[model samples]
Target: MSDKASLAVLLCNLGTPEEPTPAGVRQFLKPFLSDPRVVEVPRPIWMLILHAFILPFRPKPVAEGYKGIWKEYGGSPLRKITQSQVEKLQQQMSENSVLVDYAFTYGTPGLVEQITHYRDKAERVLILPLYPQYSCSTTAAIYDQIGKYNLGQRDVADVYVIKDYYRQSLYRKALAESVDAFWQKHGRGDHLLMSYHGVPQAYADKGDPYYQQCLDTSTNLAADLALAEGEHTVSFQSRLGKAPWLQPYTDVTVRELAAKGVKTLDVICPSFSVDCLETLEEITEENGEYFTEAGGKTLRLIPCLNDSASHIDMMAAIIAPFVDVQATGQK
Candidate 1:
């Protein structure tokens, strides 16, 4: 490829273990949890606790959880799905003279390696973190990694990062359409729960826009689907530690809904661009049981966009403007 054939888009996501084993889970978690962006606690204390307490006991159970959701293809669902997203995006943008690839914020095919590989080859590189909402923990961590990598480089390519697209029209439409399709197939449920991955309240209070962004996406999605006030609800999930996170917490809200006599529920995670452990296991498996135990009949999970054609179209549209700006610069 000529130097001009050097436009590359690096699609990024939080990673998963290479294998569903304790050792593999530990390796993935150590670096991931250690990131100051992820855990705001002071490093020295956090490290001691992590190494002594968390790593020893946490990995085995987490690995078991991973085992439950591990794809038959022999890796975490996140990895396989992300790889598929990259491949589909490549095909979708094939005629545009751009190269598309993906990397993880943690684990294999890391950010630095992927960035460096394309650095010399691509004159203009777009770093699109798969997170639709900007959060210090997610999108900012991608920025941090790219910033760190550039520090060691003598020559850096022009880089563009997509911070968030929470309210993007095409994206919201894609999400709404996904939900509509799900309902059409299974029939509409009594309630639609929009669950987002939660961050600590401290982080939101300090100025992370993630909480509000998630709310915005939920509202717009509801509007797109013409959902009435009582038809849907928004909550946060996947919170860890004792620290308070953005609420109403998903599990709590789910139980409350069930107790309130809502028999059927359809849940979706709008914040997640793809389905992973949180959706596959936590929401579907664990929370499904919670709903049933609480007197609700069914808890249906609408899968994330993943490599679906609509999702690919949305991604292509999202990246088009950035690509155009770079192409203009080349002239």
Candidate 2:
């Protein structure tokens, strides 16, 4: 693989609607929800539920939620931020014998297309799924796609996939710095809420490490920020269906904290690499209302790291080991 002249790095993330409309939402949701890694239910029954019950009604309301955060640039916040991340990473590595690009796990610029684009130009490809904490539903689904793509090819590039980086020192430092910077500008709140996106409890019971990784990330960040025992809490958000999910659910916890006289809360979603409907609509808008309605003065959302200079530097560091700079004659 080192014999090839160039290297291609592919950054991937969960997708968003192409546009903030029902049809767009449906297009994104269909491929996303249909994945067994995501849904996990028996397919025959799940398909009926998805087609008859879900698709008919879910798209419009979801589209409306997306519209609340759609950018003037004509896409969801996740798409815009991810594109910026790719562009910055490319510029950051411009002098190296490497090319950087990004794609979605389920939407436009699909994984297969991006992988194919690099097949001829580069001898080696590194895939980095942008989930800090790995879960079967998210990270494993990416592997499934790559596996499917590899099945059709006689010749494939040398591929390296980063499974997770939840515990990397640089990543944790970047997260802590982002939070500290937020506090420096806005001041600290009564308590910090580190809310991660939830998965069904059964997934953890079956040995998914996502729950533990989220806890580890929160623990590391809290220690970095020097928070006392009572100063921070961990919860899970964006649960679906009747099945039990990792709990101390965010909405319930927010209401309870406000009722208990905890005022001026600080909330951050550690699970999201970029702000999307979950953070923008669900956390900032919906759950913010829940807190204030329950007597809290404010629920301040600390932004994701996104494409900040620190974040790009951290990304470059994480991918450095997989890149053969000596082989490519990079710096």
Candidate 3:
């Protein structure tokens, strides 16, 4: 391997617990909820609340939710989906002689492993958050981890951060294609609800653009699909605590639609690149039941972007513009 070899691309994501147990959820949620960026509460006070109240009480229920999404792969859906993504990305980049790898902000395949792998080998490194949109809690947390890893490197390689590609054309096209494919397989529903993970209103008010970006993605996707006013809806989900979050809430909207005589729904989470508890448990199992119970005849979940062929193409397109030179007959 030459020291002057082309770029090494690493895609990152928010991770999942190692298992579907209380201890597992505790392990994952502790760091995730502890982050000031994610929670934004005072350390002493928040720690007391987290350790004393949240961790002790919330773990069992959260673990149960994890159980709902646990796959036969011996890990949560997040891990499986992300692993598939890394593999597909590697296949795609191999064609261009661009090395592709991935890691999680939390859990195994950690930043340490990813950094060591690339920094020790590659000449130039590109860190791309697997997120489509930027959020202080999500994307910024990944940035912090990257910074921490960089500080510990013996030989700091040329590192470039590919911030957010929420509006990238290829990305939008992939998403539209995924949704269309899903609809084709399952048949189009009366309404297409685009749901995204919700952050607190305080974060958005304080300048987090996550909410706006979600709206932008939803609008663009709707336009691309040529969905009419009543054809699709957008809502936020997975809210925590009493703090106000982006609304209208997905559950509330689903029930409302049911009451209004909407019989079928196709739900998709554009914000999530992988299938996890949020998508599998909350949206599919719980919310699907909720919608059906509320008089909806059917509630079909269009799966996340994941590592589908179209998604891999989108990933390649996103990295193509950033690579210095295209490789020839590489893979």
On lDDT, the candidate that comes out on top is: 2
TM-score of 3: 0.93
| CA displacement after TM-score superposition, residue 98 of candidate 3 (Å) | 2.3
Error of 3 at 134 (Å): 0.7
Error of 2 at 199 (Å): 0.5
Candidate 3 residue lDDT tens string, 142-243:
778767776876766577877788899888998999998987887888888999999999999989999899999998999999988878888999898887
Report clashes for each candidate as comma-separated counts: 0, 0, 0
For model 1 the local lDDT of residue 91 reads 90
Residue 282 local lDDT, model 1: 93
Tens digit of lDDT per residue, candidate 2, span 148-257? 88888787546778999989888898899999999999998999999999999999999999999999999999999999988999999999889999998999999999
Q: Return the TM-score for each candidate structure.
A: 0.96, 0.97, 0.93
The list of candidate 2 runs beyond 4 A from truth reads 1-5, 71-74, 328-331
Model 1: per-residue Cα lDDT over 1-64, one tens digit each: 2556457898899998888899998999999999999999998999999999999999998887
**Comparing candidate 1 with candidate 2, which one achieves the higher lDDT?**
2
